[model samples]
Target: MKNMNQLITIAFFVLSTNFFAQDKQDQQNEIVAVWITADETKIEIYKEGNVYLGNPINSKGERNTKIEVLNLEYTNGKWVGKIYSKKRGKLLDVECLVEGDNLLLEVTTRFISTELEWNRAKS
Candidate 1:
């Protein structure tokens, strides 16, 4: 009876761990899609290995060309990363969250922090 109870406990622990890991993966994948900024710039967000990256697909300025605007990794139940600021001419700390059809990105710097919203592009 003791051995059987121990086996059941171990099995439950393993199953619960697997379930939570899978759930986190699903949450992380939700950000993988094309998002459009308020200025109508299209950014494609994709996963490369364990990290998520975003790049602009369509923009007129040379600054927006062939640059990784976003580099994110999931940690502590949030997506933490750095985003390239074209205006600031550098990369800044960014946190990303998906709320409904909007992707909220908070960019922080030494002096100020601001949030930008990007809408998920329709397929």
Candidate 2:
């Protein structure tokens, strides 16, 4: 009887862990929209099929800039992707997290690390 109870406890823990992970994934998946940074830079985030992308827009709402975020995939509780730097003309690895009303992005490279905070834009 004690062994049976232990087995049931282990099963419950596994199920609950999966449930919470799925919940977090669902929340992260809902980040398909436009967001504004603290410096008023406008970025439009969208998903094309399974690929998540981001582009910067100008005052005229034209996506004339190069893609900012590309090939984003939700994995291990965060969005892992690549960000294109127009100034440097290079690609950098990026990780994104949606925290409360903010989207936190971290960009990393061999010698540089950048963190950006963005809020969902109001339509």
Candidate 3:
């Protein structure tokens, strides 16, 4: 009876550890449904292959913009991406994080770095 109790305890410990590990991974792997920039440009981002892509959509009855966000990669708690500006005809480095109900974005160029906050558009 004592040996059986020990075996059950060991099994329970292993199972509980695995459960917690899976839960932590799930939290890290969560994807934001949508994010809206301060300028009221709403975008839907999703993972495709190994990178993420974003598409603009209408917000508050405003016309949907044709701009697109591309080449986002997540690693080590930071998101690395690029935003192409049609006006400048260049791509800028963008880093982002999902903090609470806001998406914090940092756009960095050769001469300057700008940080912007995007509100979560969906749960």
| Candidate of highest TM-score | 1
TM per candidate:
0.83, 0.68, 0.70
Q: How many clashes show up in model 2? A: 0
Cα lDDT, model 2, residue 5: 100
**Which should have the higher TM-score, number 2 or number 3?**
3
lDDT of 1 by residue, 1-123 (tens): 999999999999999999998998998899998899988988988899989988888545223446899999988767899999999899999999999899999889987999999999998
What overall lDDT goes with each candidate model? Answer: 0.89, 0.81, 0.74
Q: Of 1 and 2, which scores higher on TM-score?
A: 1
Give candidate 3 misplaced runs (Cα > 4 Å): 1-21, 58-67
Clashing pairs in 1: none
lDDT of 3 by residue, 1-112 (tens): 9999999999999999999989865544454457787878777777767667777776464424466664587777767889876557898998887778887888888879
Any residue pairs clashing in model 3, and if so which? none
Which one is best on lDDT?
1
lDDT of 2: 0.81
